[model samples]
Target: MFGKTINEISLNDTAYFEKTLTQSDVFLYAGISGDNNPAHINEVYAKESIFKERVVHGLLTAGLISAVLGTQLPGPGTVYLSQDLKFLKPVRFNDTIKAEVIVVEIDYDKNRIRLNTICTNQNKEIVLTGTALVMPPRKRMDI
Candidate 1:
């Protein structure tokens, strides 16, 4: 059920992915991305900062948006063209975040799509907002 082609897509087509952030999630992201900022990994250092608590990496939270696009809406073969994001709030450990995507426009001639991307926490606070441009998978030709 992956790889929905441009012809099969439409305005307002949507998808979502949800996950609860964990300490291990933060640590692993830090390790893999080499973004071991004190605000994200050191509770003591974080306590001294404005947020007053360890916060998840902004990009880590934003990845949920990628999750939705790659695995749900256009799925599998979708090629991400670009994304513009704004981080609105801090996400602490244990926050359940849901990333959502909505097709705001489509360019049939170019096979490109513009999508409204957003992420909200369990408390329904918008943590991130963005727009993404993607090329949905091409139609498969019969063998």
Candidate 2:
């Protein structure tokens, strides 16, 4: 039973993953989020925009953080408490974005952790930066 007990996670632990946005991803997000802003889906409209191309939704990029926290770093069964994001650059279609999470703080008593998260594109430009709070499983205590 001791071996099965939930273990604590540390800040030094890290998880890195990458994903490339496709036209389908753009379309799906546009459809689901109801954010059919021309900048995201309309080619002609996007061409005239500052980016000169269709850009992925900021929320889509931020969503990668959820993947990192729920699957890799803290593994399954982790609960996301909150996330704060800043969009620094635009993420365009066909852009391969890399998401990284570095554990920053661990609250053992509360079973919570703070992570410094960032998403960067192929150009190595940081498109998003933020902090994520997650609740990982903890060893059960019995009186």
Candidate 3:
């Protein structure tokens, strides 16, 4: 009786978020998170590394997943409980990423949703995959 009402949730509910990765995005993330890894910030070092080019911070890309959860699907009132992520590919500057989430399971009693999350580049290559556990709002509010 305390979480999202059973009637308000359903399987297969989906949400999406998109952004074009930029140099500023990487730099700002580094400044804010204090993760100035060379592979993400140094052109010379990155060119020598396996990727052979600068790569975006993994967590910055993952933040798109958070945007989807916080702004869509279960939306504004949902409480993020946990997540499991697997990075499949590198994200580079200028790559347009589309992040998506689909509801796969609903716990009626607990008012929780288990969502399958994924992010793909403009080329449709999967770059990130994960599952998120969240608690939706207890009651609907009129907009």
The Cα local distance difference test for each model comes to 0.93, 0.83, 0.89
Off by over 4 Å in 2: 1-6, 139-143
Query: How far is each candidate from the true structure, as Cα RMSD in Å?
Result: 2.0, 4.4, 2.9
lDDT of each residue in 1-143, candidate 2, tens digit only: 11111255655778878999888998998899999999998999999999998899999989888878766777666778999999999998899999999988887777788889999999999999999888874643222
| Over 4 Å off, model 3 | 1-6, 141-143
Task: Write model 3 residue lDDT over 34-81, tens digit each, in one string.
Answer: 998999999999999999999999999999999888777677777899
Global CA lDDT computed for model 3: 0.89
Clashes of each: 0, 0, 1
Instruction: By lDDT, rank the candidates, best first.
Output: 1, 3, 2
Query: What's the best-to-worst order under TM-score?
Result: 1, 3, 2
> Residue-wise lDDT of candidate 1 within 1-143, one digit each (tens)?
56788998999999999999999999999999999899999989999999999999999999999999888878888899999999999999999999999999999999999999999999999999999999988973222
Q: For every model shown, what is its TM-score relative to the native structure?
A: 0.96, 0.88, 0.93
- For residue 14, give model 2's deviation from the true position in Å: 0.6
Angstrom error at residue 96, model 1: 0.3
**Winner of 1 and 3 under TM-score:** 1
